[model samples]
Target: MSEIVIRTASARQGDIARRAEAMGVDDVFISDLVETFYARVQANETLGPVFEAAIGDEWTPHLHTMKQFWSSIALNAGTYGGRPIPAHHKHLDKIKSEHFSIWLALFAQTLHDIAPSPEAAAFFLERAERIGENFQSILFK
Candidate 1:
């Protein structure tokens, strides 16, 4: 029955959440990752200008949204509801294809520096790589 299916899905989600928590993937970790990664992005010569052009000086809102986005991806918290493709499309003029690689490198570095465990770092990196690949495929096509 549909009711049973729904319950099963919910239970699976709950189990995943518990596993994430056991690996130290919580709001604090997500916030730290976003903040640290964006800091690197802002400092990078390649990524800094592109991001500055798109974001201007309004970084607080963007950081908050990113925190929500990563939390949703890593924890299944269902916090992010924004349309990422449309949001990125608005800045397509500034976002170069190479920038995704730079972004992923910075993200990996951030995870390496701050992640509580190798497992946690891998978890975020796997999702980040997938997202970067998906965005590139969609945006560049």
Candidate 2:
């Protein structure tokens, strides 16, 4: 029974990857999205300071990790293995609940600017929203 469930889950993830590819999502796209979005984040007055405090002057590693994270989330590539909740929790003193909304807005704008298609934008936005919600639940609790 567990085997059946695992197989079914794997098949579902495969279908999602195929659908994402049909909409023009790939590793390059994920990399571009992460780069563009982080650039926006760094430029924002509100999010910039918080992120700077958390990441300091080293952004390359964070950007790479983010690319892996998005790849795992959107394509089920299973490349990311970081603990995001604890990572966020480490900066709890600086992170505010309102920051999630700002982050989401920036993410949405980035998707609008560079996503290959509307479907692809929606695909990423849906996942981003869910991730934000989950983080809020855990971090705020």
Candidate 3:
């Protein structure tokens, strides 16, 4: 593995071991955030179709993956190991700028509705925005 990946994993492992020191985030909060955001995605007219087509009857596995993903992001739990870039790249044809806007909006709202604190919400939102920007650049450029 590259040094960057190795360092990142090491940092994340330390983070997971340290736990509440990062931002007071916990597993339950991440779970709630992922679940609520996905539920909103499922009901959304614009995003629902794309996600449904990609996910279909695999919601259970998807949800589990999402939980792990958010946990990895919010808590650096190292629970998820999948690559998000390639995953999103596979749906590049279905994604658009507006889709990212809607996603960020829903993510922000989910954080507001379920986050443990304002700082936690801001923390996650900042990361989400960065991730969205990166995805947009790759998908559009």
What are the Cα lDDT values of the candidates?
0.91, 0.95, 0.84
Q: What ranges in model 2 sit over 4 Å off?
A: 1-14
**Which has the better TM-score: candidate 2, or candidate 3?**
2
Per-residue alpha-carbon lDDT of model 3 for 1-141, expressed as tens digits?
656544676786776646544555887777778889999999999999989988889998999998898887766667899888888888867877789999999999998888777888898899999998998898788
User: Which candidate has the highest lDDT of all?
Assistant: 2
> How far does residue 100 in candidate 2 sit from its true spot (Å)?
0.4
Instruction: State every prediction's TM-score relative to the real structure.
Output: 0.91, 0.90, 0.83
Q: Can you write out model 2's per-residue Cα lDDT over 1-141, one digit (the tens) per residue?
A: 355444688789989889988999999999999999999999999999999999998899999999999999889889999999999999999999999999999999999999999999999999899999999999998
Q: RMSD of each candidate?
A: 2.9, 3.2, 5.2
Q: What is the lDDT ranking, best to worst?
A: 2, 1, 3
After superposing all C-alphas onto the true structure, candidate 1 shows an RMSD in angstroms of 2.9
Name model 1 segments beyond 4 Å from true.
1-10
Off by over 4 Å in 3: 1-24
For model 3, the local distance difference test gives 0.84
Q: What clash pairs does model 3 have?
A: none
Q: Comparing 1 and 3 by lDDT, which wins?
A: 1
Which number leads on TM-score? 1
Clashes of each: 0, 0, 0
